[model samples]
Target: MQCAYCTEKAVMNTPPRCKNHFVELFEKTAHETIKEFNLIQEGQTLCVAASGGKDSLALLEVLHTQYPVEALCVDEGIAGYRDTSIRDLQAYCTEKSIPLRIVSFADLGSKSLDELNPTHPCSTCGVLRRKALLQYSTKYDLIATGHNLDDEAQTILMNILRNQRQLLSRIGPKTPAQQGIAARIKPFYLIPEKEIRAYCLLKQITTNFSECPNVVKSFRWRVGEELNELERKQPGTKKNIVTAFLNKHYVREEHKRCEQHFCRRCGMPASNELCRACTLITIGS
Candidate 1:
């Protein structure tokens, strides 16, 4: 049978069956969440974090279809791997005429990805990227990520498992509206990983299929794979978890109070003695 929202006359024999139908679902949820969170106001400039991966590419496409978006790309100095991804990201952004800014791990510090703590290069990369993006404070009204439903669910479960209730509370579609920090929003917060991959396939977006080679050894990867398997065994599990997170738990305006002071080490905003970025860098160094 043909998909509900597909313009194509041909049909694929996949379960849940509709290729374009999921796009519509994704777009609807995206728009609704954007509206509900007031994530973007008219004439606002938004920055999208494009990792040259499927989820991020799809996010760029969807956002381009709706609002004005600029892209921020961070090259983690992963040797050839990062260069290739950066070229792909820049090419795609150039095609859409979306302004792109490139930052390098070397610029952030002399350290390369391999030079960091072997156990967690991702945390370092994330911190540096955040610091770089924040430097572009003038151009962006909001910051967006490609994190989908699966990511949110995984993070929530992981936080709960670690008994980090405070951190878990902030993992939502709309991160709390904190002052001085650019409001971060995830339009694809309700989307599933499989559906996002499908949309990328249908739209022919270029993406790196290989998981981040560095993170493969991490505990998070194991948890992520377990979650993926569980998702296959049970549909809507991610959505259900996210819904419960929203309904049963509410993130108060008080959550903002945590980062009221600036990190003494890095001068970035922070609640404790150090910002996450500074903490990671210091620990790694």
Candidate 2:
């Protein structure tokens, strides 16, 4: 097939674009998302919540072009998986001369995620990882994440399926800063996951392609699979879901109703007396 914009052979099927055009589209989408949401402000410190995956690394690569960015990684201590990814992350950061900070479950005085033995591994790890990010990223003005369109769509559907109204309300391209938590931004909010992988290849960014060992067992994995299937059958299904959710008045109203309190144990933002991370850690202990 030929490229939509040029006679060069196409490399991506989504838009029938050649290598150069696909790369252009991917970076343009990310930059537009940031500008549309005002995700980054001038003279503000930015730290990317990188996981050494294609998505995060791709985000880091694009953002670095415009801003002085640092990388903050959370090690869930998932033995073979996280260790390999972190190695790739370290190498990339070193080559780029970007500052990198890594915090592990052990650093939080909890067992590694592999050793946590929780009923829901993803849920347990997510809470702890979020806490680790927020806890250690206080110095930064914003914490950027690599949540793409696919991830955002899956999260929206998952929250709706589980009737997690509060979480659904919190969904967006950027989250405002609360009392104790730093604001978070998602510059790749409109980019597809496939484009991110392709961008990494084109940019020669190093990333581990392995999936987390525990992902297959999570509710999100199931939801993501279903969403992918739907997206396959119906192009733009994921985008429509995110767009509708974002424009819905109910989500905005729900977000206003959502209240935040400090966890008694860690003094971080929480809805209850103890933050989700502290509660999960206590349960695991």
Candidate 3:
């Protein structure tokens, strides 16, 4: 099939575009999303939460083109998984001359995720990872994550299914700063996971395609599989899910307000006296 805008053969089915056109559309969408959300302002420091995965590397490549950005990675200390990814991240940051910072669970005085032996590995790792990001990214104005449309959709669905109104409310392109925590932005909020992989390939960004061995044990894995099946049956399902969530007035209002307390142990933003990370660390210890 011919590309919708050019004579070249189409490589993407959605909107029917060739390689060049598809890459162009993918990048343009990210820029548009940033502008639409006002995610970054002039002279503001931006840090991308690089995991050395396709999505994060793709985001770093795109955003670095127009904005001065740095890379921050969390080493969960999972053997063989995080190590390989960190190597790729280091190489990319070095080649681009972007400063890179890494924080590990060990740095937090807690054991590595693999050694933690938590009952819920993914959930445990997530809490620690967020803490690591926030703790180390205090110098940045905003922290950009590589959360693509699929990840956002999965999160929305998970929150809805679990009736987590507070979390559901916060799912969006950007999250405002609360207390001492840095604001977070998702430039790929509208970009699809497949498109991100394609962008990485087209741009020849260094990425580790390996999946975390613990992913299959998580609730998100099940939801993602179900969501993918639904999307296959009905295209645009993921986008619709996010759009509908964003259109809810209650969600928008809720996002504007948050009740935050300081973690007594770490002095970080938390709903309770102890942040989730501190609590997890206590439990693991």
lDDT tens digits, residue span 200-221, model 1: 8887778766667777766567
For model 3, how does the per-residue alpha-carbon lDDT over 190-245 read when each residue is reduced to its tens digit? Answer: 98898888888777887877799999999999999999999999999999998987
lDDT of 2 by residue, 1-285 (tens): 999999999988866999899888888988998888898889989999998999888988998878999999999988888899999999999998989999999888889987887878898898899899999999999999999999999999998898888786558997888775778999988888888888998888878787998899999999999999999899999999999988887876876777466789988877899989998888777
Candidates in order, TM-scores: namely: 0.87, 0.97, 0.97
The number of residue pairs in model 1 that clash at the backbone is 0
Q: What is the C-alpha lDDT of each candidate?
A: 0.73, 0.88, 0.88
Model 1 segments beyond 4 Å from truth?
1-22, 177-179, 282-285
Q: How many residue pairs in model 2 have overlapping backbones?
A: 0
Cα shift from native, residue 274, model 2 (Å): 0.5
What lDDT does candidate 1 reach at residue 49? 82
Candidate 1 is scored at a TM of 0.87
